[model samples]
Target chain A: MKASEISVGQTFEKVVVEDLKRTQLVMYSGASGDYNPLHTDDLYCKEAAGYPGVFAHGMLTMGMTGTLVTDLFGAENVRKYGVRFTNQVWPGDTLTATATVQDIRDEDGRPVAEIGIETVNQDGKTVVLGSATGLLED
Target chain B: MSDEKTVTFPVEGTHVMMFARSIGDYNPAYHDPGKGEGNPVGAQVAPPTFPQAVAQFDPEYPLRIKDGEAWFGSGGSPSGIEGKPATSGGLHAEQHFEYTRPVRPGDVLTARYSQGETWEKESRRAGKLTFTERLVDYYDQDGNHVCRARGVGVRTERPVDQG
Candidate 1:
């Protein structure tokens, strides 16, 4: 995104995932190589781990939330992206991610946009909160 | 507490595409290089969180199941290993990434990991929480710094209360 095209308080949002599937969690585990049974093993999660069932990996949630950030500031434009996991995400939960421009300023003589990010599940509970700095187009 | 743990990661287009698909990101820059001519990075680039995939290359990564090893997850039984805590592996609390430049396909990255910090907290849902931090620095084949990843993991004294 261009500096001239964006302004403080501007927001971008997207339904990153709808009715999240356990299969997608498996796909994430396979692709990201995070084979944590808490995410992929239904038997372990219930009988062994005492959870409802398999849940999404924290990195998977963070990565899903990052789609909004990368959509606004291209993957290459992002200089920094950080997040704190606030809640667990399970299958059948829909997630929406929002990114709001917090500030437009210069960092080391380069224009940058400071943005705030959040991902909320269908119940409106936050699953992730974060911020990012994206280099603006000259 | 810092120890020298290194992993070699080879950035490949197919891997990047699979990762992008997993996250529901269909950006052409991560999938088809020929279609990314308008990409600002001038090339196909990996996603911001791609560095976390370095765990795949770490020989000692605990999350992955190694052949002939006693796995923590279940097969026929609830767990393959006995007397292990339900939350033994812990949970990711936070993750941060700073990039000097975008990672591109064909870039062989050497990542070095070290422990960062440790702290404790008391929570109603999770009881005593011990948090540990880890830092990883990634360098390209030419030895140029590519990215720095910092992660925080929390181990709870017991299974976190849903309520």
Candidate 2:
């Protein structure tokens, strides 16, 4: 939907992923070069360092949410996106991300759309929260 | 941490494609370089969050070249009062991204990393929580700003386990 046609409180489609896996974590580790044991080492995460098991990167979740924004306003249309990591995302957990149109208005003679985004786990616990701004293509 | 930490690297299609795959973003525009032929924004495009992963290209990054275990092993105790496991990371509190233009493959981007403001708070998990914000701004070879990432790294006197 174009930014101008979007109304306040209009929630977009929910993007869902199920049973996040250990290999996914490994892939992110390899790609981002963030080999933090807390993220990639299942042994350390589970027994040594003291976590349940491997977990997803905070940016991973944020990136998922960003994809939805890009889908709506085109990747290049995004002006700003921000997020807060509220909870840990573990293997076998399912997540759902939703974006809501908060405001659409003119800024310095250009139309802009403001959106609120959230990602919640299967347990309905909010794992990520933030807001984003995008260019309103005419 | 320096006042301004800068690193320069050529944006390659391989890195861009790998990052997209890592995130499961199968967008063809990110993969097929030829898809941009006659397309307005030429040059295979990188995902919006690609810049976050670009830190890997920064040879001088604080944690660059360190394996997962080594990175964890060296997290020095935040407390000057020693006798701890040497693990110091509190939590990743928040993150932000702003883009002026889409980054394309072959753009010799220069990323300027700088430490931003830091503040403290009392949290049930971390007790006396300290939040450190870091900003990374990417500019093309011609010095046009392309993107900016703002991330907050947390630290506390005591260790807080996520699990």
Candidate 3:
């Protein structure tokens, strides 16, 4: 699957927000060994931190985006994937991810395609926005 | 909390490669030391998931709460949060990462992490849901900016209400 094969400006079937919640924070903290209180403490998250509640991890949202790209272009063909946290995502918010063909360039003269991606919640708020570059395998 | 002391580690090729392998990613760019057609730059490049392995410490690191102000104590869920026992199992909910540069072999990497944010919400079955974000930053040997990675995890209150 080469990027050249897919039409430019192709869009994936949008994924609806499903089973969104904040429970995974502990497991992720255990797995990644990251124990930041800003993410786990309730009183800290509320009275002290002033967040609506515990919020979803930004990386968790980014990983969902990676899964989307992997589904579209397969994991092996993905060369580079990245995203910036634009807005915070909360449990129960529906998110939609869309990508647009940005350009095709040669990485050291090798064929590569760049796609701009934006993940927006049901409120039409962009939670994550960034670009991903993939090498088209012949 | 802004003046919290931080811990740092100088990353080496071995650590990066090991982290990649631990994550089950075996990209040649992460394993091979030679450059060629298969080897894009002739030096092993750390896999994208490798950055999460670096360790950092923050005094105010948020404690995973099972209930109220107590931190989850059991190694695994179904035990308890801080003190109160849990009623359900935990599931991986999501992740996000941003890379400034690809980590290459021999590039000394340093990482620091801290608690970013925490929120709680209602769940139909679990009673409550919690989400936490961890901020990770990576730097090169020359002190050049490398990458910033963030991981989000969700913990539930009930076993049947897993995500």
Model 3 misplacement above 4 A: A14-17, B1-50, B56-163
Q: Enumerate the candidates' DockQ scores in order.
A: 0.77, 0.49, 0.10
Q: Give each model a TM-score.
A: 0.97, 0.87, 0.52
Q: DockQ order of candidates, best first? A: 1, 2, 3
| Stretch of 10 with least lDDT, candidate 3 chain A | A43-52
Residues A3-119, candidate 2: write the lDDT tens digits: 557788999856556788888777887888776666766655544444566678888777766778777776667788999998888888888888998999987677888999999
Please give the lDDT score for candidate 2. Answer: 0.76
| Model 2 lDDT tens row, B1-163 | 5748788888888888888778777777677865632234655787788888776887655544445423443234322223435343456789999899888888999988888999988877656778899999999999999999999988765546554
User: Against the hidden true structure, what lDDT does model 1 obtain?
Assistant: 0.91
Interface Cα RMSD of candidate 2 = 4.1
Write candidate 3's Cα lDDT for B1-163 as tens digits. Answer: 2422334555466665554443333444444567312444466665555455453232344433333565543234422344343322233344455556666656667676667788888878556778787766777878887777665656766532223
List per-prediction Cα lDDT, in the order shown: 0.91, 0.76, 0.57
Candidate with the larger TM-score of 2 and 3: 2
Candidate 1 Cα outliers beyond 4 Å, as residue runs: B1-3
TM-score (C-alpha) between model 3 and the true structure: 0.52
A70 Cα displacement, candidate 1 (Å): 0.9
